[model samples]
Target: MPSTQRKKIVFTGGGSAGHVSVNLALIPSMQERGFETYYIGSHSGIEAGLIAGLPNVPYTGISTGKLRRYLDMENLKDPFRIIKGVAEAHRAIRTLKPDIVFSKGGFVSVPVVLAASLNRVPVIIHESDITPGLANRIALPFARKVCVTFPEAARHVKNGKAVHVGAIVRDELFSGSAARGRAFCGLSAGKPIMVCMGGSLGSAKLNRVIRNNLEKLLPHFQIVHLCGKGQTDPGLDKKGYAQFEYITEQLPDVLAAADLVVSRAGSNSIFEFLALNKPMLLIPLSKAASRGDQLLNAESFRSAGYADVLLEEDITDIRFVHAVQQLYHNRGEIKARMKSHDNQASLRTVLELIMQTVR
Candidate 1:
């Protein structure tokens, strides 16, 4: 029989689905093994509603904000916010007394990670980007195990503890059938499909550029476009374009059916594309993204030959068409590469490592 002492695991981080999905992926496995789980995120971030009402889990929120590039009058108020977040996080940690805290890095993770460390709770920090984010960098030395999605990220973390676990993806990505996926979206099996999703919120630039070239895109391929609520211009409400605010439950189905995926270089989207063995055209947002990790992630995927990378500033109608055509025509190579590149054991390996560290 197992010991009476409970095994508690706390996962922290949220803003984008990219940061939070890994925790969601890990939950089932940990629960099956008899571990109690808790989640910590920000009240203001995108994860609030998603975490709410989930079973066998307690979700808590801390006040957090991004560290902006240009100093503003608002910057003066941020120190107090950070202090408040740290205090709230410390209180949460003291209450939970988790066996270990697994953090997916972001500004939201920083204060919680710091609080966990101060309270002497074992911390596991996972960096899902090709390059680690600022919060990850700040908290790296404190983590007992620093798990990375890419080998390139290892150099930045001062710890010899950093281990590359690839990316933790839901099993649905690997199990969905392409035929059913096509039928569900009303896309033709005979025609190739192109999927463009900008994480959960979607990408405005991808939406705009693709909208500008929709006529050129539609003739050759069926389109499943997720134009984030912010990105859906009225211009895109037309035929042959399956537009969406988000496709939470049906995402894997749409992805599996697509021959090629056009997306931002966010780690979650990139890894999911790789897992599904779908060829991809990666359009990375410019240096505008808080940490500029997407730029590096896009370049890494491009260099690996699984996808093509296009810079936001450099993208144009002709170049976009040419890149899409190039990928479409030679997709066999990309598909072959994706089949050969396997990293599906990341979640189990990471969870086991975390449990071992706590033991």
Candidate 2:
């Protein structure tokens, strides 16, 4: 018989919203199965704030250093920080004695994965992008199984470790009502709604371009712009457009009301849009700002007939409006493609894998 005792699971991921969202999706199911969940992450990172608010999951903050690809003075100090982080994580894991550690592939997760491996705890790492991030590549050796959203990613990982389980989407997302969303945003049913998401930290370039072309856009569509933290424009309070710094509890409603989406190509966000059947125009982060994972993610979506891609560096007001128009015209086809695929099965598969690993 399966053990009657409540098993413990440790989750480690952060740095970006994409890294943390998959962990959130699995938490409710874990709690229901009588698993005591704990999260280990950076002291003041976005994950700390996000995980701290969860009811039963106790979050432990450890010293973590960013794994940078470029030359920087901080890179020298970061190695020592990582060493300290590993020691701290090792101590935490030793005390917690979790049955397993689940990582969502962020810099903060590297130390935690290493610590878990050292303690002989099974670790599962999930990669959201088509390609593994540097952090995941570093922690791959320590992971017992590597779960991936894309089949292409499995090719990059060691043989037998990678599992293509699709993407984990929050259950609450399916419960959103378009009417309720419209009401929350104070929009009428007259115009199609376009939800513009720049991600948790926001995208200044996307925000600027959208605002600059609002005059042309508002006539055809109502806009709900999730402009990121501290990026809301105070002066541009115009009709047919609403701007929010960020949305948490009401995100589903906002998404439910959206007819089209203009957003960054984070794997988690795009997969959510796909599951929701929202046709999107993806403006990925430039290679200058990121490792071009978003660019790759956007391209994959475009190639798969899921979304329209617009390179950030090449965007102009005219081109931006034209792309949104193109996405709108092709919305029906995109929605058809999205409906043909159900990626939510990944949630159950991942949960089962975790259970199997624990047993």
For candidate 2, what is the TM-score? 0.96
**Residue lDDT tens for model 2, 24-79:** 99998999999999999999988987887799998889998899988999998998
> Of the candidates shown, which would achieve the greatest TM-score relative to the real structure?
2
- Local distance difference test, per candidate? 0.84, 0.92
Name the lDDT of candidate 2. 0.92
lDDT of 2 at 257: 93
Using Cα atoms with residue i matched to residue i, what is each candidate's TM-score against the true structure? Answer: 0.93, 0.96
Q: Which stretches of candidate 2 lie over 4 Å from their true place?
A: 1-4
What is residue 131's positional error in candidate 2, in angstroms?
Answer: 1.0
Worst 10 residues of 1 by lDDT: 231-240
